[model samples]
Target: MIHIEHVSKKYKKADNYSLSDLSLFIDEKEIFGLLGPNGAGKTTLISILCSLIKPTSGSFSIKGLTYKEHKNQLKQLIGIVPQEYALYPSLTAFENLKYFGSMYGLKGKSLDEKIHNSLDHLGLVKFAHKKIDTFSGGMKRRVNLIASILHNPKVLFLDEPTVGVDVQSKNVIIEFLQELNKNGTTIIYTSHHLNEAETFCTRVAIIDHGKLIVKGKPKELINNNPGAHNLEDVFISLTGKALRDHA
Candidate 1:
């Protein structure tokens, strides 16, 4: 479970707030989606939640623990998969994973088994010994995902987990996430893939210009918006067609 209250963020010397008094809650075992175009503040919100950055104002707590008073507990309670590939290109997949696992205080046979099982599950077992620089975009994405979840945190925050991947890789990643959700890991992910979120998310929030626009079940949102037949339709109706170009 997650709780946020009037959270806001403004970059140093920036013209505007990246997140402005945004507030929302994500329930346990729920697959929650944050959908927005470029410059929509999705990543900013996630970064604040992950404690990669502190909020300029207001507060949030995950599973009854605030980052201020319970930083260590919060660290152990969540996993983060950023949009960028957070891997050492020179390291083998297995080696990279082992390093990550150790950060969570895992060791020995247990960590090894976890790494191998995750690699196998994500279709990368054969490439376990292969260097990350040799892997394709999709393979790297899968490896990035495996690295985040090896510690099996109660909540997983993923920023564009499927971006730049082929359809096959996307499917594998989505299915893998669905399985994780089914087994009770709360998932909060940001994505531009409306169709995927339409079916994959239990609830979704569409935000723009650092604020919440709408939030609800995908079907409920679609049905409530007249003439909207799908999530994309509702999204366009709300967010509009202008390009969200930014520096």
Candidate 2:
């Protein structure tokens, strides 16, 4: 469903590429995980795929449509839940969602129903009228996710959708995502939660220094790496124990 070819990116005056000729594919309905430590180019690659940033070289296509030739179509084809909350603090949850849905050309009673259903599913219906600034981190995260799927996108790109939530909220989010996947949404997400990815993802790619170091089923990767017992073990073995700090 998604194809990336020799994609590369370099920020202005950067010492190294954020993504270097990286290539991969994600099948329809697959939950693909991009796992790496900080500064490993995961977000850069997602940003490129989401068309939030342009690649310095190479290209990619989603569902046989390139952003260059099919910008509007591609915009309708995917949803994005960024790592940071993309909500209006002053707006009520319902109000914020209505604004977001309208961006995708959604309106009327159907849009209202969609928002309410999503809020109920994510356990935030009670707070629908509350200002975003008053919601807890978990509530805002849930609202953020609801905003992305109002139009029912074919592909969902989530960057750390469960970053700061409590265990209950995380479980709810994961369950909600699993439901979406079951209904045919292809999911590609980047997360530092190795354990979650191990069980949640159909396959995963481990990247470092702007390159794909390994890609496979979590069990396959774990079994293939000698002495590795889990995805975290495989990750540490492949990416190493050193810090990836960058300015």
Candidate 3:
């Protein structure tokens, strides 16, 4: 459902490309994972796809609609759950959802029902009236997810959706995403959690230094690499053990 062709991005005053000639294809309803170390261009690629930033050259299209020509239509087709909490600390959960739902032009009883049902599904029904500032990290993450999917997007892009949550919350989020994929939403996810991506993704691509190194099913990648017993082993084998510390 997504096609990226020779896409590259180099920020102003930067010496090298953040993403260089990256091309990828993701099928409809597939759970695709983009894995890499810090500064590996995963976020750059995602940001370009989300139209939050423009590419320095090359292009991409979502469901055959390019951002330059189909910006509004593409917006309706995709949802983004950013790594950061994109919530208002002052707004109640219900209020926050109501506002986001309206962004997609949903309103009235329909929006209300959607918000309540999502809240219930994500185990946040009891805190619907609670302010976001008062919620824990897990609660905030759940609410952040709810905000993105309220419009029932056909393609979802999530950047580290379970970064700091507890195990229970992570499980719930993964299960919820699996259900969404089952119902026909194409998902593009990026995470450092190799174990989660190994099982969750239908296919994964490992990129580094703004280039594609390998792309395959987790099991296939693991089996193909001699001495690699798991996705983590395969990952470390390809990306290496050096720390990716950045300012």
Compute the lDDT of residue 89 as modeled in candidate 2: 100
What tens digits encode model 3's per-residue C-alpha lDDT throughout 1-247?
A: 9999999999999999999999999999899999999999999999999999999999999999999999999989999999999999999999999999998999999999999999999999999999999999999999999999999999999999999999999999999999999999999999999999999999999999999999999999999999999999998999999999865
C-alpha lDDT of candidate 1 relative to the true structure: 0.95
Note the Cα lDDT for every prediction shown.
0.95, 0.96, 0.95
Residue 127, model 1, lDDT: 98
Name model 1 segments beyond 4 Å from true: none
Q: Candidate 3, overall lDDT? A: 0.95
* Model 3 CA deviation exceeding 4 Å by range: none
- Colliding pairs, model 2: none
Give the clashing pairs for model 1. Answer: none
TM-scores for all predictions = 0.98, 0.99, 0.99
Candidate 2 local lDDT, 1-247, one digit each (tens):
9999999999999989999999999999999999999999999999999999999999999999998999999989999999999999999999999999999999999999999999999999999999999999999999999999999999999999999999999999999999999999999989999999999999999999899999999999999999999999999988899988877
What's the candidate order when arranged by decreasing TM-score?
Answer: 2, 3, 1
List CA RMSD, all candidates. 0.7, 0.6, 0.6
lDDT of 1 at 51: 93
